[model samples]
Target: MRKLIAISSGILLLALSLAWWMNSRQPQPVELMPILTGQPEYCVTCHSDLPEISASHPVETFGCVSCHGGERLALDADLAHSTMRGGANPSDLSVAEISCGGSSCHTGSEADDRDHIQRVMTSVQSTYAGAIANIRYTFGAQTDLTAHQGINAITDERTQTGITALEIFNPTLESNPMIQKFGEECFTCHINAVPREGESYTRQTGCAACHSTEQHQLTTAISYTQCNTCHNRGNYDLRTMTFVERTDHLTNRLEEYYQPIAQFTQCEYTLDCVDCHTRSEVMGDGDLHSNQKDIQYVQCKTCHGTLTELPLTKTLTDPNDIAFRMAFLKPVVDLKLGDTILVTEQGEPLWNTRVLPDGTYEMIGKATKQKFNFRPVMGTACEQKPNEQESHFCHECHAVER
Candidate 1:
């Protein structure tokens, strides 16, 4: 009975102490966040603590209103995002003109820094009409493969190529059942195709296919994984010579598959697609190419270097080109070739390249800072064709005994 009484008193004391502490403390004041300067947006009030999207798209300079169209002064979520384009992704074709293009970002010639919108429209990847026409022709539904068989973008004449008529799958137009079925089932890979709900970022339509590296984020360093989302899908029906839809099968690394048009290359497992393919090739040459082969001009010899002559890299008179100067922050190997200057995508010349003692032409990636060594095949025991420079001929050294 004595111990129980003492325990009750202790509990009463503890409760009184907690009440006293609670009574002593006053309510803290809420510190209001400040709006961002320059652009005059209140988005920074919330997203100020958030990480910057990328080095290029600085929030302080670009602000929220530039790429993502939103009410700068509004505090409410719905009001701020009321007129936003492409939701979280402004680079989408539907709103890309006002977002990514305009007179500012990515709006000049493809050779220049501002031609993404111009180049991509005519790119083979953007236009699935060629592929659709070819398949229909092969299946005997169409007489030839020159017809435009997909929804076409209304672009300028310079940007537009081949046929510009907007087309979809039509059973009535195509007499052959296979051609009819082909249009209905397999017509959504083009740039115009809107993203289905809950699709992967890589499978997204339009600029998102390459630029939107993540689900909602964008980046310059795109990986090969995204390329596989579209390229690795489906298969060819050898007997019928028709492309048939197949399930997206993810297998172990050992059981790998590649596009049959390309030779079974060592680079298949070794390098990323972007490593070999240049910006002009993938982004496009500002031409409406019939196929991917027409645009992709980077040969094995380009990177590996010719067997005999060495490429030169020289200095320029002045830093006239602002874009190139920014891209070339530092030299890779710093191996100076002759006196000729090396130019980047902008056609502005680069400097500070050197040749290694091993006879390899060492150069830095224009903007990526990637180190490259172009080995001259002239001295090597390579059984290349007479002036032939295909990858299949170069990959003979790593040929498996199969």
Candidate 2:
């Protein structure tokens, strides 16, 4: 009886050990499902509006998940549905080599954030045009405008590079290579929403912010009409008018073709891809107007800040007060740094600091005269609601609104 009992106890212990081992060795599957509903679609629905990015390749119909890895159908805001984190993962781009730039899109060893956006846009467009031709002509005939433009009998024929309606496409023209505006770059003319000094927060704006376009008055967003933002009316003739009178920079010999100056010259200064050509000459071959033979042409401001464009502002000499009230007249202004402003006869102030949130200001003392009025040394003023008496709150007169 004792032997039988010992045998039974040993068998029971062995069974328990086997069960524990099996449980420990079992593998658990990782949860890669998305946490949010209508995820990839939600992002795609809006991103598709960007024609250069959405009109071609798998992205035309495929959702964000196709390029930017993530659960396309996620319903929650969890890590499982995350697309890119700490630069580890990014969208599966079509041309992986083109992802060298700084941006949230692709984080690679070769990526550069400085102008990644422009490079990406240009690459995507070039790739798409090539792909479309492959499908339509099967063997890359003169199907697209690029080919026609490239093969034009007159090397100086005009073509499109996207921004303005101007057909300033001339192969013979030299370009400012550093001013990547002619190619797929965005910031060459675009601006991001960022915070401003004295102002809590401000939306991103373009040249149109300060420069008003009679054509775009009804529109809320900035437009090219605001060209004087940089090229003021006074300097317009100097930049545009002067270019036309000079000998063709492409062909050293005087040419008959008129170089189109479509933009307001000041704000719309960057050249599109066609502006920088590999096979064109402007002025006679060996003159200052000729293109660089071996080196790529770049804007002086790009690598060298020799021609720094400082923001211009109107003088605000407070005859009564000693401090000067300088105001920047750009599209977006910041008051976070704190400034002193004087109320103008118009509802607008003489020196508009940065735009305030909620379309209102923290009026401390009387709007007119005070020790500390929320104003900046430099800024511009815009049209405001007109009233019989200027609007003022007691708090703005007494309390320091920072």
Residue 206 in model 2: shift from native, Å?
Answer: 20
lDDT of 2 by residue, 230-328 (tens): 211121122222211232343411111213322122211222111211111111111111112212232212111111221222233444331121122
Model 1's TM-score against the true structure: 0.70
lDDT of each: 0.58, 0.27
Expressed as tens digits, the lDDT of each residue in 6-54 for candidate 1 is 9999999999999999876733322322233354667766655656666
For model 2, the superposed segments whose C-alpha errors exceed 4 Å read 1-52, 58-61, 78-81, 85-272, 275-402
Which candidate leads in lDDT?
1
TM-score of each: 0.70, 0.19
- Model 2, C-alpha of 156: deviation from truth (Å): 34
Provide the global lDDT of candidate 2 against the true structure: 0.27
